[model samples]
Target: MAVSGARPRVSWSCDPFASRGRLVHEDDAPPRSAFRRDCDRVIHSTAFRRLRHKTQVFSFNEGDHYRTRLTHTLEVAQVARSIARALGLDEDLAEALALSHDLGHPPFAHSGERALNECMKEQGGFDHNAQSLRVLTRIERRYARFDGLNLSWETLEGIAKHNGPLTDRDGNGVGRYAAGLPHAIQAYNEQQDLELWSHASAEAQVAAIADDIAYDVHDLDDGMRARMFTVDDLADLPLVGNALLEVRTLYPGLDVPRTVGEVLRRVITRFIEDVVTETSRRVAEADVASAQDVRGLGHPLVGFSPEVQKAERAMKDFLFPQMYRHARVERIMEDAQQVVRDLFGHFIAQPGDLPPSWQEGRDALNEERLARRVADYIAGMTDRYALDQHARFFDTTPDLR
Candidate 1:
């Protein structure tokens, strides 16, 4: 049964009943809490369904077992919830952030995003994080009262700032990517401030770190499954190496598959435990008593220890060349990028070619607005859909096989 009334006091945790409320006001549902409803809404969104066909590390056609965006989101959600539960944070909020985090991702993984970014470079830019905000606040049109999901303010805050503040207090860009805030996010923030200068809730912090953990572990699993690298190859890669050594010490005669599974299990446990321990230590040291305190702390209250962070970086360093930049993956992504570029070009040149809904206000839109609409249309497409559309427009589309 769902808990009713005020959320029980938990140190550095968000209280559902005391939430910042939604952008478009509405009466509350009786049984489910606000955060729980936010989670359910995201699960039912068209964007969520589309993730099943979107790429993670490999294209969908590559194999049946490779991770899709949907699978990755689920893994992130699971990790977020586990961390939330351990830290007495709001699990629903964490899960919602995790599930919704990738909604903005274009097809073909990072390559598609890169292509889209290049296509939109003149019209601001394309960013998955900003795109996610657009997906939640504008693109999703399920609700009659509002175009977007109209999620609670806390959820929106997490969605916008989960990766950390985009700008400083003066509204200037902060990080490497933040120098130019995407138009979508900037427009929304004008109407409703997402506190772009501050950290998100502790739950959001948990979800963000959980995303890092999920990708680190699952990408390794997928890379091995794809034969990009082997277990012995990862035997010297920091945390993974340590996990492999421990697994071998305990289970000397285990088969490769079982050994892989065991190593992953250990890796997950190690990271989760480290996060919980380190976060608890930080909370105590910083005297963080509430979710707001967590957000205002400037630094993340939930993350791996410095030692673990170093090890994780080492793992990523190894994977960058062996898995991400492997010749086969590179070739496939090149084809995928071309498909994105081709679709964007075709649609921009001939706005009439877009679907009736997409071209609804095409008559009055300026060049930049039209380009954004085309970007939106292209961004929403699945990998197979992109290929099919390319086949429709161009004589030869890359096989992407």
Candidate 2:
């Protein structure tokens, strides 16, 4: 309800970059601010618009009901907003972070990412989170002078730390960042210091949690609808089956469809409740004249609260065995990787070959720009387009949607 001491200026962990924009929330308004405005900017950005054609699980043509990247992102934003509101968080900040989180994701989820990363490995690895940051900060266009829209620091911090721990250039915490450390943590081992600032905002962590919640449940639903995995099949996997049985015990009359729906709803509600309760307690306890003072807060929403975190962990374990770790998904992933690999090899091997847009460069140095240029070209494609390009260039059979 109220905030504590003067909020420190938000700065990039190592770059000494501070947010330049003003916190523009109206004083009378109970729920909005400049960071919130940043979120709105992301929702309206063109990069955010492309999510509709991106993949969530199945291919574009798999079915109309399947989750597209756009739909998934909307779901993530919705979930994140719910948690933010419950926690008395800056709703706009969470909304903007969730909206822009996936902008850099390639067309085919991790598949397109793998291909792009492999191709650009030498230049800079192509993780979607990094690319999303790149998109918002650089690649996404503007009629204005700069290539990037120059989003607020809050929004960009959310993007960078949405995946894991926020780390400094030397791999230490931002002055006050004290949440869970990133697994396999290392200082920016690379020559380029692209590692996101160590002090990712609490709002960003909330978005990350929202992403996990959205996908973990939806992926199972999608798999079931596609007949890739059945309730019985899922229930048979060791501890997962046991958890499913517990759900059955709780509602004996419920069928698998209803049971799955019930479980998902329960988890969603629990997650939201935990986030709201914890976050509100944090904010209300804070010693606040302004929203700006609340920057760099820790994870307001616990990844797993002591009460439901175990269940959440169990649910994730179940999904891991029953859906994500399933061989069927792996096969699809393999096919996708091959497509990316082949495309990269072909494009790189023939440097003279350029996309129609790149034909104007007339010198040998032009070849040097080819990699970055090709990366730009590939990064902009939707999933369906990426496949088409692969097939067109590789003379492979066209994949049906």
Candidate 3:
């Protein structure tokens, strides 16, 4: 039960024992705090299991060693926990947020998401974040009483606002990324009030930054492994280049894999240290006394410093051209989009094509409702399942491999 090197739990840390309870109340189990229970529930969910076959950057058929959604979630959880532990925040809450962060990602990664979003453009549009909320609050039917997992308010709030507040004080949308809030988030906030105008807990902030760190680091590794780019090619990029330089200086003529591995390990370590140092400085500078104070500070307490942020942006720019927009990736993603579009069109036309569970009561629903239902079913599919369905429905399914 003891965590090694754990700082005394600070006032700004979300106290799991004092957590805001779940929507549909249930008796608490002994020994495990509410946040701990939430972590377990997320790990056990059917959606979590499907992540093994879900794309992170590549299709499931691409290679065995590539990062899937499940692996990415695990990496994010690891980084989040490390940062949370350093900041004396609730590690379980951070881990839970990290694990649940990608639950709404569709079959073919961003391509599938784009296709779904376009398909539902009239029905309030598709957002993976909103879909994630729907998945947690409505989709996963497990409890005898509640439809979703019925996670604690703290967990839900963390999930809702992890990337920062969605609205301003007058309930109008705020932030550079905020337009109108997603329909799922807006609807849920109406019922539960996740304080859309304020920042989430520090643990949630840690998880959000951890997501950025994992994406940057792991995508680089995957990109290298897939031969989309080379380590030598990245030797001029920002943080990555610096890390590679240090690795080369320390161990001259190391093999390519070991050299790349060292660079990645260093990249993760440097980012974690930067976040911990910057967050500690921000917490001290703001004189935050409680979780509420952390939330109301008008800026995130957890983030990279200016230098690191610049470097991170540079790295992303490098990846956008060298990896994300590479001809091979573009070709496969194009096929992936077509597959999602075809599936949506087919299911909307022939409702019976959906499984019995998805088809249930869909006949009674209106066009928008049916479309949303079909979207949900499609969104929940793994890459293999999506491709298989495509193969079944269409005469020629593109070999995404």
Candidate 4:
């Protein structure tokens, strides 16, 4: 796959991009289109594979049907691909962006991410998006140029921007070295973009929404299976309850299981449709110069329409209050956070425990890189690996390395 810069003249399949003629230039050798290259790099990255073992709220082994981070990513890819295809966007680029969107998420879900962020607070804070960009451009090793994945700027930007606030712009989320680092000021200035730093691609936004859709409904499904909530209990949820009543009234013969499935499916379908329609309409209206140029374009529809948005807001409010905030989930989050914090502390205080690659000098440049190394080690952990590390640190695991 072609690595850096634009390649000219290649035939693009999608509308805006195809209008641009080609994103790759003729001078580029070892030829591949930029978007295809981005897709390949993500597929080959170690971080992408490790996602299989990472938790997506529920543990990987909790049930045969629970979604791991890997499955969640694939679903996002599927959803984004469909939207991209419908909207005349570059499917390869969109799918690549979606598949690698969560590459930097640490073990045990957002709780672990929060803990890692706190641990790195004085070290510039550990945002999974920034870390994912770092992984692609500076960490993941394979085909060699700096021991990193050497991904295209487009893919890296998409990953960093997947959950970025609407105000962010191109290259905005790339990390800047904090004070005391040798080139801190330079890094910050160089990284700053025309807008907010967390900007994601329109395709990335599709993936982000897909992630929300999967987790929101799936978590409720899991809650039911775990007996955390009964059908009656779910029917008691304010928004879901209201929807349930409507569903039952419309289809008197539908059983609770079928009704539950239909409700979630309907919500997801409705939201997805709203997003796709809005995105396509906005894209066509924008008069974009090309598909490559659309990478930094904001989603014309950030979320659902008024009615659906209200229901979605209500659903989120209900989920937070009823499911995520429940004692069982809270306890799991707390445990995961503590485990992450302890592991980070252990690695920092005794750097020798890390692999030899991380044992470099404490010079300013090296210090920044070392801190990143710590983040990488922590970021790469699986839920089980994190638990074992915690156990070893606390003397609960006798045979730990």
lDDT, candidates in the order shown: 0.90, 0.63, 0.91, 0.63
Which ranges in model 2 have alpha carbons more than 4 Å from their true place? 1-19, 22-37, 164-166, 169-197, 232-259, 280-302, 350-369, 398-401
25-136, model 3: which lDDT tens digit per residue? 8898879989999999999999999999999989999899999999999999999998888778999999999999999989999999999999998887788988888899
Residue 262 error, candidate 4, Å: 3.5
Model 1's lDDT to the true fold? 0.90
Return the lDDT, model 4, position 23.
Answer: 22
Q: Please provide, for model 2 over 59-120, each residue's C-alpha lDDT reduced to its tens digit, 9 standing for 90 to 100.
A: 68768988989999999998877766555455667788888888888777887787777777
Clashes of each: 0, 8, 0, 9
Per-candidate TM equals 0.97, 0.75, 0.97, 0.77
RMSD to the native, candidate 1? Answer: 3.0
Supply candidate 4's per-residue lDDT for 217.
Answer: 69
For model 4, where is the 10-residue window of minimal lDDT?
Answer: 1-10
Q: What is the lDDT of residue 312 in candidate 1?
A: 88
| lDDT: worst 10-residue window of model 3 | 1-10
RMSD of 3: 2.1
The clash tally of candidate 4 reads 9
